[model samples]
Target: MQSQDVAPRPTPASDPVVDVEQAEAALVEHYPRLVRIAYLVLPPGLGRGRRVMTAHALAQRALPRGRAASPVIPAQANGRDGDPGYAFVRLRVLRAALEAGGKRRGLPKRSQLPPLLPQVWGLKLFPRSGGADELALDQQLSALSGPARAAYVLRGLEKLPDGDVRRILTEAGAADADAALRAADRVPARYELLSSPEFDACSLQARPTDLMRRRQHTKAALAAAVAIAVCGALVALPGDGWGPDGAAAPVYAQNPAAEAALDPGRLVRVTGTAWESAARTDFSAWPARGDLVDDDGLLRRALAVWARPGEKVRLSFTPGTQTGGPAGPPQLLYAGTVDNARVVILYDGLRIARYAEPKDGTAGAALDFARVDGASGAEAAAIVLDRADGNVRYLTAPWVKKAAERDLMKPGAGAMDLTVTDGITSPLASPATRAGACTSWNVLQLTDDTGTHVLSDLGELVPARLTTGRPAKEKDATGSQALHAWAPYACSLGAVRSQGVRSVNAWQFAEQELPDGSGTGDWACTRAETWRGDGSRTLAQFHTPGGAYGAVVAKAEGGPACGPRDPHVLAGVLWKSEGGHWYLLAAGSRDTASIRATGGISGSAQGHVLAVRAKEGAQAELEGTLEDGRSISGLR
Candidate 1:
């Protein structure tokens, strides 16, 4: 999904979007779940760009909808006076998602949508726990067309009113939620909604048609902003990371297929640890975008894009001997890879956690192959494995099954394919499409000798600009920058982990620049850094771990630390990753040409920089600062 907004939406209904303060309050407490809802509502087939745009746009639109049910209170309405802020925020988000996903064509400019066919494998439901409320809302609803799924999630999972659900679905371009539900067909049996006594009274009256809807929802955009807290987490790794167990280490262990290393050719291996890859940790980044705001109108972690607390997945791997060797970090390494395994991942509620690849070539090496919440804490996760042969495998945690999947303790439905890249598939190529649209969402569910498994059909997960928002202390009703985001389409997994394949060899051998056709090649790299004031004595580094690379130059000057003990008054860096090593074709730095700050001493330099002008995937570690008192570091 290319990231582009639908022409600004007409704010319909009363103002569901509260003043900045209230919107921010809702964002702090419930934004993550709201994002999850938005994710559910987006059709996965959208490119990362499109998915991101639609989700954010929907959120923008949602903030002001269904508000006829509620109006603004005077000043203290930002939940300061005990307003039902959570309910207000969620309804808007749900409305936005439904509307966004309901688009049958791409953007209006897209003219004709390729089609809405998603690939599916019957194995879909991902129930975190065996309990009743443990719904794999995403997976279940994902298999259905966006409109239908939106209906069920709102009415069934969130328990929204029948009227709201009907209006939401219709506004999203569907005839009605019931009709979308019928299109899914499997949902009724999966949720047993039609026969369940619990839903006996959900008889909703149909709203007017979409044409009439357009007439009703014409209004202005929501007013909100996202402010970011730069000092503690953004400027550098969490303060803890700068000191102890918080640093991002490769945790590299030998690939169990050590023998394959001798075989040459492409001996691919998949490995990682808990809550690490395919997840977001730089919460401090993205705030400058002012996309998602909280009650204080600051940019913040909008939501848990992947794992939430408690959602654990226990991964099963081969048992091997333990030996320790120091590569990046030293630990017990696994001996060999597990074979013909029946790995059962477990989940609790919808929060996914736990899940590890038992071995890494060296034995006793219990490394968390991949994680949802970054390093520690359990959260949601989806697994993918790369066979030495070229194809990929998707696995559902023991408890996490697709939504439409029937029969819990048995193989439900699942599917597999090697063509789709970056979790996206165009309907034009799928036989599942109908007329220029899809008759249904196309995520495949598959059942195998190993229980039910789901190949990652990223085609269904909608990507969006993720951030949290809060109002600024100084009330400015007119200050929210309409939120926006961009989708950097991935051509390949490259140095990055498969979003589906939770784990991959940290260093793909010589994937980094190595001793090749090189003469200190052009310095190439993508980067991020920070700085203080006075004489710009600085620090800087380059990043190329994900394969993004380029030759780069840096310079800085300083003044005084903004405040006492605040060594960094001003700091900033920009860089991107690459499939090949980055090259610092040339480089230089200087603090002599500096200035003075608070104590007459130049401000301290605190920035990072790097260069990978190598041919093979290898580069010695380089770390330093830039001109004008900035601190910089390299990210692997």
Candidate 2:
């Protein structure tokens, strides 16, 4: 063991050019949420949990293999671009912590990272109040290292010219101070050439072969024809070949076999793709025909069943049945509907479920008619759409034995209803009107003032001081699954999607408050969260106990930071106005004075306010103004 040391291998002159494709794929894959990203970039000084490693893992998983080694160095490299090694280093640290028993080993999950606030102008979440100094912002940014801060700010906020920014980021080293400062000033370079795949492909000299070009032309012609025919039946069939220059093409009817199989007056049920749907029309005026075509063009055999919302449609198959089955050739019949408003079936009138090709197309939740204890003519059908292959198959429910009839009625009154309000411009409505009942769910809708209408069925609203808001959990059922109690203002929220059982919907409304406890300005909030347990129990168990309660409280200018380890209450007079500002005043005694609020008047004009009194644990009336100058009167 005397002395035989080996020399280190020389490192490559340059890291392999960051893999652009790999990096892009990674970014697309994880697609980190805004809050999740914030939890990483923002210092632990804020009330963030130890999930930075999880975030990094998600980001890493986004990239393809070998691509992760060479992430497309962000094209915009100006400012303190993130150190290429930083993310990897963090990942290593997190993995190490996890391996070492994490907290039990006394290891910090995430380093007290400095604030990598974006350098972009006008992204300040806090108002430009005299009390809130740049030093304070710097202190907030303190968790981030110098370069990390610069990178976070430029990329996250200013959204500087990324290409040049990328160059600056790649070139700047941890050792250079002046270069680092200058890097901050450099505008992100515009590399339009590499910005998009189309542009990149066009800039290259690769030319298509003659045969390839001809094939492309053939594809284009075929695509055009298909589009014409698929959209409106004007497209010529490919098998028909080319037609004389301007000669009109002839329509291709179904094969004689398929045609022979189809009959209009016979009440025949046709189950097939849009191509097969050519036999039906949309919004069919005749009750018989209308029942067949849905707005989406999905063929419905029991159209008469759903055509009249609450009507039961009875259908009989032709005398000589072809498809063999215990119940003979399946005769399409409209069964009794469940939900009242829109016509989507409800399982046992409660558990909440539906079958749609585009939504739950996997047939994972398709109903089984054959399995039904008491059956009818094809009690149900299962349509499977493989997201991977875009293929669809329809299978009849297994339980149908005999046909039965039941009265269809609308859902109960307390059940919610949805209407397109002001936010969305389109007037289209989902075919299913009833909001299926689900124990937990989130409703993400736009508010009148361009804010969000984030609601949850939290048994009932709880109490919390202002500073930040809690996320809402929404149920995931088919159709207009849930209804809104009242018709507030009209706002169009595109199709609603579920976040998850635990994924909560957060909200931030704008308002102002008086120095005393009385309410003053306009403020409204639909943010809610409910526990899965008993309704009688207080909702406190669902969130961190001894923390701020319902109705977040914050400082008028600075904030109402998280309290010390000791449990205590903090209150503030919160207010909002149509002028695009929110204010909170100390109407009563409250200890905390400063707060960092998210989801307020942002990227758009809106007003808000939150002020905490000198004492901690106090109450005050909540008030604010609406865009129409209406007063936001009361809150318990």
lDDT per residue for candidate 2 within 1-636, as digits (tens), equals: 000111111112223333455344324422332123323333333322223333334344433355432211111111112423323322322222222221234544333332233222221121111111222334444544445444544343324444533443344333443454355444332211111111111111111234566788889999988877776643544766556767645687435433322222333343333322343221111111123223322223222222221111111111111111122122232222212111222122111112222232312112111111121111111211111111111112222111111101121222232332111111211111112111122222222221222222111011011112322222321122223211111111101111111112222233334444344432222221112211111011010112111222221111111112211122233333234344433221122222322222112113433443222112234443443444332222
Q: Cα deviation of 357 in candidate 2 (Å)?
A: 3.3
Candidate 2: regions farther than 4 A off: 1-346, 358-570, 573-584, 587-636
- Worst 10 contiguous positions by lDDT, candidate 1: 297-306
Candidate of highest lDDT? 1
> Which whole-number lDDT from 0 to 100 does residue 350 have in model 2?
10
Worst 10 residues of 2 by lDDT: 535-544
Q: What TM-score does model 1 achieve against the real structure? A: 0.27
Q: lDDT value for candidate 2? A: 0.25
Task: Quote the lDDT for 260 in model 1.
Answer: 33
- Give per-residue CA lDDT, model 1, range 1-636, as digits (tens): 011111112234433445655455455433434554565566656633344334444444434323322111111111112334555555566555554555456454221232233212222211111112113333465578767766665654454555666665555456666777566556653432211111111111111233434443432111111124334355666545544467666688656444332221221112332213424322111111111111111100001101221113211111111111111211111111223221212221111211222222212111122212231110121233212111223332222323222111112222233333222121212111111111122222333222332222221111101111111111111112211000011111111111212211100001123223332222211111111112222212122222222111222223222212322221212212233433222122222122112211112222221222332212232233446545533222
TM-score of 2: 0.23
State the C-alpha lDDT per candidate: 0.28, 0.25
